[model samples]
Target: MKQLVIAEKPSVASDLARVLHAKEKKKHYYEGKSTIVTWGYGHLLTLKMPEDYKKEWKTWSMDTLPMLPKQFLIQPLPKTKGQLQAIRQLCQRKDIKEVVIATDAGREGELVARWILQYVRYKGPVKRLWISSQTDKAIKEGFAHLKPAKMYDDLFYSAQARSEADWLIGLNVSRALTIQYGDQLSAGRVQTPTLALVRKREKEIESFRPKEQFTVELSYQGHPLTSRKPLVFSKKETAEKVKAQLQKETAVVKEKKVKVKKQWAPLLYDLTELQQVANQRYGFSAKKTLNLVQSLYEHHKIVSYPRTDSKYLPTDLESSMKERLQAVAKEFSLSGTILQKGKVQQRKVFNDQKVSDHYGLIPTEVAPNISRLSQDEWKIYQLITKRFLNLFYPPYEAEEQTFVILLGDQNFQLKQEKVLEQGWKEKEEGVSSLHLSLNQELPIQIKVVSSMTKPKSRLTEGQLLAQMEKHHLGTPATRAEIIEKLVNIQYLERQGREFIVTPKGKQLLTLVNESLVRPELTEEWELHLQKIEKGKEKKEQFIQKMKKEATRLVTEIKQSEKEYKDFALTTKKCPECSGRLREKKTKQGVFYVCSNPECHYKRRKDLKVSNHRCPQCHKKMVIVEGEKGAYFKCQSCSLTEKIPDKKAKKQKMTKQEERRLMKKYSEKAPAENPFASALENFQVQD
Candidate 1:
């Protein structure tokens, strides 16, 4: 009997097809003597929307909220219905007696395949192909020892529970708040708490009051010494007095301590850590880094799975270290050095217990062709490659020196660090050793430095990801997208590198229930989800808990006396209806919307009149800004031209010239206008 294999995406299906020798390509699948391989476009089936279950749920109303469906329904995504049908047909093929689930080896991946199977009513015996990397050897080994699909039932349950819980909580709470507030507000089990974190940080920054303080710094034999107490005096008079005392006295070394210290290399890159580093180093958004790393893993076939949370390799993978090192030796010089050193030992880097679903992101046996990669992909690949090579290197060893100096009644401390061995830090410069004579008195110069206690800095995307990981607010695969979603919904705005909570975001925090906005609640839910995955907690129990929680939250929002005021008032009036326009932010950037919700008139705020004239209309073109860049758009004849740079030089117009030009345009009526015929043609088409 022929076996059918299903993959997560087209790229993976192609890799599996080549390795399985499935050369006979069909419309939607590849066929061979013993196997037929097909693929899904991420997810072919998704959880049904609220309206799909009932007619009353179609409109956003408080009465219809707390949408606790007895049995959540799954429907084929409208966009991918054709592909879903193809997969369903492949599953029902008379020759295919068994199906192999070869989608991603993670919780979400399990959900993607299981949903498709359930939708198609596929009941054939099934096996699972679980492998981290897409390399030929890995795929072959994975298929050689496929496990029963039943083995991953708990994982699938956990995935379903998380999805349903999110839908119930997010949709119900979001609808309740929006209905009450009369604005488009959203809250999720994880996203609300994550938003709370940003708001909390912003509040801290806003309420912070800086304090003026002073510290006395002393220099003796080119070594800087800090006060023994490390005290910050609120009064400059007190600091001046201490400085005078330190200046008059002769400093003596009371004690000296020196010890060798060893610093180990950093652990390998999990998706979160890699995203954090990329954001900090390259100013890449978390989502941008994820896309780049995913490309390196799926397209280049160089990096292993990119959505992993573990920062360690499996113990079993150690046997193939030599092969992996040799594969990358040509691209990386350190790989050759590591290969020459023979088998290197680092237990921390390879632990089976630490690995879950997939090992840490490391280079596969496939050597990357750097020339074929985009600049971002190459940078991410280099990051993973360097981290892998660093594992085999020695720990950074150094000598740390601490000296205690006595000046009158006060004692001062001085520190110096000297490198004993560069080790893993060979590429970085080492600190120089300090020479200090013990039990000797020396003349020292004292200076009082004025300083102030600054408030905490705003959270960058990197810092936000780290906080989310620490709190278990979201999984590695979803954290970046969550942040991006918050930005898209206008709850958070980006200012340079930092995330600023908008006025609407602060209002959202105030309106939502305190318990729902706490990270601890989301963390607890995540813990329970993990339990469901491990079979320690039943999926029904989690779902019941979520239902009850959703009910309570909806009731709280419904009965709340809190008021929400629209803070997005703008001076511009809507063209469709003579109503005041309000500023609204969406994924496509900021735009102005009519205050009258029924009118539904919106225009981009980025549009500005440019000096460049439309070739067809011969009128000034308006500059339209977008995510990528800006372009010139003519409203008269609907002509568009790309602006070379967003900051195109503006045409200067003197007051007299502007008045004269305005007068010339004002004198011409609509019927007599030069572009009137072209405008009429556009209107007729519309």
Candidate 2:
């Protein structure tokens, strides 16, 4: 009898098929000599939507706000019913004796496979194939030593608990707020914490007080030596007094200390870390980066697993390091010196204990041939491949010398030059280049004088991050995500790399319950979750606490009398009633809707254009905000267009003017897609 293996996605199933010799591929299944591989697309089954339980819960009403069920029910997603059915058929096959859960090796992955098995009531013996990297060798080894699925029962239970809890809190609270506030305000465990973080940062940015300081410097032979500024007082009068006193004297030679420092190659990219780096350097959002990385992992097959939190690898895969390194070296033609460095496998980059579900993203053993991949896929693939090669090479070591001089009672300092070792960083190309040295010594033309006061070091994002790292609000893996979430939710805005708060975000912080928004809450939760993973803490206990906290929060919200004001920019009142018109977001785009519950009046604000002309009637178009984003619509014709800004409508445009511009720019020739008009009301009512 053959062993049946199930993977999370078709890409993974295909990879496993190749490894298990599963050559015959079906639409939803793959057959091999000794294995049958089937796959799921993310999730095949999820907790039933509220409307699935009862009809009345379909509409947003305070009456149905906390729609928590006595027991959770799993139902196949409408789009994935065929796939789920195929898996169920495969499970019932008489020849398939032992089933292998070959899905993702993480909590979500475990849940994905288990839910399908439970939903279908698969009653066969079960085993688990756990492997991070999807190399043929790793897959082969994993199959050879498959463990009983019962070993992961606790993990499954934990995942289930989280799912149910998220459903209970997220769905209930989201519905509650939407009903109470009378808007489509969706919130979830991840999104809420994310929003709170943003609001907090925005608040900080709003209250920030910028101050000015002064510094003095001295000149050495052909080199500029700068002094560190010391502010004697926070008052402007004292600052001016110090500046005047400093002008009376010149700088003098004081003391000099210089040393060499080594900069190690960065650990390999995990998904979150990669997202952070891409966001900082390329301005790509986390979701965009995740989508890109997923393509590289599944479609390109150039990068290792992307949905990883670990920045390290397992020691068992250590033996394959040389071949993998050599493979990347041959493909990228990295520095000859790096390839010759004798594939040094260091524990610093590979430790099994540190890696949970997936190891850090790395290059696959297969050589990356980018001919089939799109430009974006190639870019993401290159990032992973280059980072993998850099890890094996030696650190980018640097040697530096410092010269210090003092004038009067103040001290000044200067650096001579930067010298690079150029080992691992050599392989990095394009945007992947290392930012080794920014303070390079320049030739200065001035005579040596008395030492001056030292200058203050300005804070960079990197520097502020160093401080955040010390505080330990989040791990290196999650810091970027935390920061990005804040920005996306309008809690924080970037002034260069510095974060600035926004008013709405500030108001959110002042209005929401403080304990729910505190960073320590998540920090503590993380610590406990880690313990639960290690079996040091009971998952049930942790969940009970979370439930208790959630209930208390809900109760508090219900009792609280905090007032919320609508931040609408539209002047038009509801056509159906006297209620004010406000922006209501739909999947299609934003539209003006009546705030009154009884009045459901809405307008498309149709500013969408096609080929610079409105789609409805041929004319030039003007851009307007909709639920989805921004779009150009005909001003003359009663036509609308859709735009792509995911954030809600900006406050500038008025409703009537927006609608007028959209009609004026309507396309003279109509487009074939008739649903464009229907999309304004296309929200999934549930």
Candidate 3:
């Protein structure tokens, strides 16, 4: 009897198959001497919806404000029905005596595979293949030390608790909010808290008061320098007084201080972190980057775990770094660089303690074709590839320097520095890290001819984002999406890429309680989750507390008439039914819809891609939801394809031009008919 190994996705399954020498492919499974490898598309099963359990809860009504079931139900998604049936059949097959769970190493991944096993009622002995990257070496090693599936019972339980809690709180809260507000408002643990952060930031930006400041500057020893402390002057008289004092005074150097600092390379790029960086740098959406990374992992089979949260590899992975690095160097054309410059390998990218479920995203040994990927895919791929290469290089070294010029009483000080050695910086060659190392002490010879005290500019959104990233509130993966949501919901607006909160955003914070939307809430939860992962806290007790808190929050919302309408706008009438069109919140973004049930017309503010035209019915396609993301279906021809955002498509078309083209193409006229012939006939004889 052969052992069957199932993975979360085809790429991983194929990698395992190759490592196991399962070259003989049959249907979805790869058959080897002693193993058979197969894969699932993310998940083959999921929790049943409210209506699935009971049909009465389908309609939105205040009476069903807090619909809580005694026990949750599990069911296969409609699309995964066939896959589930196949997996069940495979489980019962006599030849497949043992099963292996080769899914992701995270809580969610554990839940995904375990739930299916429970639903199928597979009684066979189970094994778990926990590997970070799909590199051949990693896969071979993972197979050598596959652990018993029962070892992850606690992790599975934790994953289930999270899912159930989200359902309990999300469903109840969503229903209550929607029924009370008479809008299609849905809330969840992740999405709601994320929204709250955006709303809070918006409030701070709106209420922020800018204070004008004045400072004195002086020229000494041919180098201009300003006062280290900025003097905030409430009145122009104070500014004039300070300016007059420094006008005739020669600057004195109080003391000269110089310090040398050593900087290490940044941690490896995880999926979310990579997504955030690409979004901030190239204006690619979070969803866009996710899709690109998925392609890099699946279609290209060139990147490891794209949905991972960890930026560091585990201890087990460290032993294989040389082989992994060598593979990457060969594939990415960096062998010469590595040989000439030597490795800058550091502990930052390979620490075992930092990893929770899986290590950072890295490309598999499988080579990536640069030509096959789209422009956005190439951009994201380059980011991952470059970071991977840089991780193997040496640490960055720089000598920082400080200079202080003394003349009379007034003091002047300045600093400058240069790289002592490229070190790890040379791995990605000239690629710059997020933050440049800056401090006093290490000094470089500088010939400064001019310097002046100028008005300090307001912080850019990029700078704020960089600061937030350093603090680690949201992962690299979710930051872009969070920012985009704020802008979409009118919580923030773009002044070139800089984010500033709007009035609506500010008002949203006041409408919601501070406890529900503060950064500290997320920080607290993160701390607890980390503790739970380390087995320092009990999952059941933590979940019980969450349930209590959720219950309390629900009760409070029901009693208070906090007036959410104060933030929601109702300025325009619905075009379809002449009813007041109110602001309705959704995961996609905000929308304006008809209040009347009879006339259903709504316009989404968020962007969606155009679908293919129906060949039979000659109508534009509609966006269809898929397991992974959204897709497009042609209503006329029944043609279906994955839908990517138009913004990421790198297309240029004005609204008028798009509408004209759509109308022309969607017309009832046959393709054979020539518009030129008709125009010629209508023209004058001359």
The TM-score, computed over Cα atoms with residue i paired to residue i, of candidate 1 is: 0.88
Q: Model 2, poorest ten-residue lDDT window?
A: 429-438
Candidate with the greatest lDDT versus the true structure: 1
Judge candidate 1 at residue 135 and give its lDDT. 82
CA-only RMSD, every prediction: 11.7, 13.5, 11.6
Query: TM-scores of the models, in the given order?
Result: 0.88, 0.75, 0.72
For model 1 the local lDDT of residue 240 reads 94
Query: For model 2, what is the alpha-carbon lDDT of residue 200?
Result: 48
> What is the C-alpha lDDT profile of model 3 across 466-579, one tens digit per residue?
544554555444455656656665566667645555565554444444565565665565556556656678877767766676676567667768665534557688765788
lDDT of each: 0.87, 0.67, 0.66
Candidate 1 lDDT over residue span 75-137, tens digit each? 988899989999889888899989999998999999999999999999989999998888888
**Positional deviation of 102 in candidate 3, in angstroms?**
1.6
Highest-scoring model, TM-score = 1
